[model samples]
Target: MNELTPDVFDALIGQDFVVTNDDGAKITMSLTAVSRFETGAPATDIDGNPLRAVGFQLTLRGPAQPLLATQAYPVDIPGIGVHHLLMSAFEAGRTAVNYDIVFA
Candidate 1:
């Protein structure tokens, strides 16, 4: 399957997705921010070598239900297709939480 690029994923903002938690609870998450604040610096390796790295930052906001998870999981978006990614929480509130989805 062709995976989505950061630009394509960013265009999918305001979309909703579903994921099953470890406890078997299905939750709904809305795509809030396609990416977090980025400086646009060229990605490089530890040795400062330029690398052709492409990544998407998906911010999922869901209800106060059990957290979606901070690990690799599969999420399905209506027309985008299913993607297995590592979703990590960066900031959260009483109602919703921000997740940084690793689109590798």
Candidate 2:
């Protein structure tokens, strides 16, 4: 299993990741974003509960269809646990659309 460790995150760069939406729709995209902060950093959630936050970006490559931010995407990553990504930002390249995602 490809565990969702920091090492795995490094290996995931430029690799394909399967993201499933609420309606169970799945799409394959490249993991193009680097983790901005180190893993296991202390943080607070909306409920003021303590937790760790991790960030990553997904790049929908060449001629890929646009994904609307109408809902959050539950990305399937081993050991990552229920990753729901909100479309944080939109970045358009010459051939790809990068979506900024923040998950805890």
Candidate 3:
């Protein structure tokens, strides 16, 4: 798999991604937005070298029920392959739930 960068997902907005739950159920989520921002302080790599100061957040919309706990989930992105991503439920309404995947 390639790096999970904003560029990798920029073209994916409005597309659908399938997230596999812990119970092995597949939840369909739409890629709603890809928000980018400055990290303020420079981030470091494992070797302690300075990395990019920019970061991004992925917003997805899915069903409201079966509220998913904040954790890593296997998500299948069209043409990007499956990847394990940490996601948290950001909001929930009567019919939909929003999840966020932050890369910082």
Among these predicted structures, which one has the highest lDDT? Answer: 3
Q: Candidate 2, 98: how far from true, in Å? A: 0.1
Q: Write the per-residue lDDT of candidate 1 for residues 3-101, one digit (tens) a residue.
A: 565667677778888877777667788888765344455787689975445545678887765766578777887677677778887887898877777
- Indicate whether candidate 1 or candidate 3 has the larger lDDT: 3
The candidates, ranked best first by lDDT, are 3, 1, 2
Tell me the spans in candidate 3 whose CA falls farther than 4 Å from its real position. 41-50
Q: For model 2, state the Cα shift of residue 70 in Å.
A: 5.4
Residue 42 lDDT in candidate 2: 63
Model 1 vs. true fold: TM: 0.71
Colliding residue pairs in candidate 3: none
Candidate 3 at 68: error in angstroms? 0.4
lDDT of 2 by residue, 1-104 (tens): 22344455666677666777556777667777555554575687678876656544334332235454546667665446556656543666656667666443
Better structure of 1 and 2 per lDDT: 1
Candidate 1: residue pairs that collide: none
CA RMSD (A), model 3: 1.9
The number of the candidate with the highest TM-score is 3
